[model samples]
Target: MIRTLLMIGLIGFLSLVFLHAPVRAEGEFGGLALGNGQLIFEAQCVGCHVHGGNIIRRGKTLKLKALQRNHRDSVEAIANLVRNGKMPMSAYKDSLTEQEILDVSAYVLNQAQQGWN
Candidate 1:
């Protein structure tokens, strides 16, 4: 019985260590490195906002153009809006990590600067 218990504890400890291991650097999200921004965007935003196309959501148009313009003023604003869920836009605070939001905002900002028209 003692051996079984010790083995179980060892397995649990190793699992926790692996889970807490630092993720390798992928890209920047907000100020956070090793962020998973693209994955979050792909899962959440891509549904309504297609690749440079217009989609009607809750009676408001979700176009890349509008988002690009909105992102111009501030990345923080975009992040906050996504976090808090601006009207006509669902709040992603529960769905995404803060870093993910920041990364998505960065992606939008980059697309805007490039004039993704």
Candidate 2:
């Protein structure tokens, strides 16, 4: 019947819209680094740096304000710290490869720069 066909068409349209809706990720780093940056953060940095706060509160916090003070908006500095690991900040060289370090660093830097919802 005409009603059945119209209902089916409406359902199909709504399904497509729902399924294809833009996926907004939780942090500022989403859609960057081909979308793998956040995954790297979850794997490497989540335990000691939950939401940019250090677990022991020893190192400088990683939010925008702290990063402005410590890193001074230098992505390279942040990257170097991630690679070399300042004293008391466990060196990730053994646990993560160079690329992994870069990815995770990019993720953190992005979040530190822009913040997240």
Candidate 3:
């Protein structure tokens, strides 16, 4: 029947909308590298930020309290810092791609939330 055919088409349309929908909002991060973030963090940042403590700047550690107080809680803020870099902290922008920065920043934030475990 024509009604059955229309229902089938409607179901197909809904399926496509749910499965192939593009991300359209900020703070989504659903498309960003999720697990690889940890790998990037371990490979590049462990030496300096082992256990989230800053070896060079002991006072400016990556601890959650410090990050919250300094307003570095969001991924954008952390990623910007990593990309730009401050004294004694080299810029990773040249070495790591934008995606790498995002992944590593996400890993850092997740680890900080988990007490660097």
The per-candidate count of clashes, in order, stands at 0, 0, 0
Candidate 3 lDDT, 78-100, residue by residue in tens: 99999998888888999999988
TM-score of each: 0.55, 0.63, 0.71
How does each model score on lDDT? 0.61, 0.68, 0.80
Q: Give the best candidate by lDDT.
A: 3
**Rank list by lDDT:** 3, 2, 1
lDDT of 2 by residue, 52-77 (tens): 88877755878878887885355556
Worst 10 residues of 3 by lDDT: 21-30
Model 3, residue 17: distance off in Å is: 37
Q: After superposition, how far is residue 60 of candidate 2 from its true place, in Å?
A: 1.1
Q: For model 3, what is the alpha-carbon lDDT of residue 70? A: 81
- In model 2, the runs with Cα more than 4 Å from the true position are 1-34
Between prediction 2 and prediction 3, the one with superior lDDT is 3
What overall lDDT, based on C-alpha atoms, would model 2 receive against the true structure?
0.68
Sliding window of 10 residues with minimal summed lDDT for model 1: 26-35
lDDT of model 1, residue 40: 57
